[model samples]
Target: MATPVLSAERLAASYTYHAYRQLIDDLQAEGKTTGPQQSELLTNYTRLNVQRMHRLDKTVQLLPELREALAALRKPYVWLIITEGWCGDAAQIVPVLEAVAQASAGNITTHFLLRDDNLDLMDQYLTAGGRSIPKLVVLDAATLTEVANWGPRPATAQQMFLDLKSQDLPFEEFSTQLHGWYAKDKTQSTQRELLALLKSL
Candidate 1:
């Protein structure tokens, strides 16, 4: 089956990094924020992750290798992210991605589409048969062809989740351990995996 072409104009109309930050702020101000599959606890966690990512956006410095890789890109591409305001993983990963796009020196443009509102696009990039949030889909701007994709979480974190799943732990315990892993990671695994994806492309 052929990969579906995502609408660039739609993506352009979607949130920019700054706009996404603003949306998160607005949602928090409303005293409520919830996605399709999120519970109250997850919603609260997502808010916290958004705040953490905002801080990271200000302080995240690219390593030398990543800098060189981003700097070397000559072809134009779109780093299209599918996410929602109440997705904790998206909050953690999106800002790091935004920082990378900024360092690309205009070779790449990053945009975000809310997954709930874009089911067609979301279905094209499902993770493990599930609609995982914070999916990063790289598209060639000129042709709108999807070149690569990465998402949900880094391999290390995903493995941790699978291990936790095998134990059939309670949702509260599972989420606490999962997010604690993300807290300690500091986006290193995310950056490393994305850098690898960029190199392959």
Candidate 2:
């Protein structure tokens, strides 16, 4: 049998974007990261992600068209985002998503769930069979059923990742290049893609 769809109760239990940020902050205070695996490396990534999120939250600007679209949305939707604190892409992407939701004039709400904590859901939305995170499942607020989804990374960034993976570079070098891409792109790709998604809905 197929797995059951996500439920309203699960969304209720999930963290709001604000609470999720605070959870990461609290974990940082304890020298920890989200997920079952704990390590110095993962903790270090979480530290770096905190800086990334802080910067993005302050700097990401939505396009006027995207903002207009969000403001015009009439139906209520929930953006259920699956991510982890140590996820670099999530750090880069989640803030932009929050910005979009904030622009939606109460039409869009966002909830965050840790990928490891929601493996069943994560499995259903895997990127190439891997549980790549920052997976966004857009649900109809009234029915709690999926309407659309996007994530792991923007299309351009995902391609960059595939290329880097093929090259088999060290994690540090690989990460630096990937994040450099996000830094240069400045959330434009993310917003544009979501704008397209919104138009289709």
Candidate 3:
């Protein structure tokens, strides 16, 4: 079997980062989110995610090493991100990705696709047998071949989540601690990991 590739038509139908952000905002205004299921909890998460994204968009600063790696790119890449508005991890990480692509100085372009709307694609990039949001599929611009991928969360964060899960903590408690970790880390772990990823590529 061949490695599945994203069709150009699919890429064309995906949202730009700005458009994705706006879509989330628009949905939140209507007390909704980005999937088939609708509920107050999801809506509240969507609202909170909007705020998280807004803050990261304005406040995220790329590390110098990551900035250099991004700036040194010789070829262009497309970062197709799988995400949904109600996802807490996506809220914490997507804006930082946009910031990295923007700093790439045309070497990277980003497109966003909702996981629910793109299950065929999402299934190909599952993390731990689960459809994890904010999963990135980096594609070579010319060939549309996948080059590298990263995401859902940094390794440390993922470990923390797994540890919390092992303890059988309630969703509310674990989520609060996770967000607190993100706030304290301030994107450093994410930046370092991506910096290494870029160097390897």
Candidate 4:
């Protein structure tokens, strides 16, 4: 058979909705007020780093292999993203998951769970078992059983992209770093390594 053409994802359109803009505003508020010079540094960081998650084409270019890794998965994956609106990680990964959802007949469902509003839900993840904000709970939607997870820090791919972009490394190198982190077995080590590795991406 001929290679299949990828169709456009509708939810993907709504995925980046006003929610992301609100995140940008929140992110600004969360930052400590700095002198004009120091503020300029962060401005550059965000300007250089503000990840517009809605643009599918640009995101893929930022990390082609990572996108493929997500594309390879079969979904119906319930992605409960426990996050604060101000978090940079949420800004990055939510869009990637949205794109993945767009690709696979909506196999992925991206739910943004605000940390302050959903204490019970978050406490479950933030506990020893629970983890932190931007924790991606990838589960079997039907059974409500978890399958796999990635996040809190490396939770959002846009953050990773910014890290990679800052280093000015090519996409292949970024993919190499990410997969290496995923390959680790211990949870604590896995989380730490992934965060460190993404920072290097």
TM-score of each: 0.91, 0.97, 0.97, 0.46
Q: Write the per-residue lDDT of candidate 4 for residues 34-57, one digit (tens) a residue.
A: 123336445544442244343422
Using lDDT as the yardstick, the better of models 2 and 4 is 2
lDDT for position 30 in model 4: 63
Model 2 C-alpha lDDT per residue in residues 1-201, reported as the tens digit of each score: 333258778889999999999999999899999999999999999999999999998998889999878877889999999999999999999999999999898999999999999898899898898999899998888888788899989999999999999999999999999999998998999999999999988
Q: How displaced is residue 143 in candidate 1, in Å?
A: 1.1
Tens-digit lDDT string for candidate 3 (30-91): 88999999999999988999989999999999998898898788988888899999999999
* Model 1 local distance difference test score: 0.82
lDDT of 1 by residue, 30-144 (tens): 6556445646665687678777787887777777889899987879889888988777777778888988999898988998888888898899888889998889989888888
- Worst 10-residue lDDT window, candidate 1: 30-39
lDDT of 2 at 181: 97
Q: Which is the better candidate, 1 or 2, if ranked by TM-score?
A: 2
Candidate RMSDs in Å, in order, are: 2.1, 1.8, 1.3, 12.9
> Which candidate number has the best lDDT?
2
Q: What TM-score does structure 1 among the candidates reach?
A: 0.91
Better of 1 and 2 by lDDT: 2
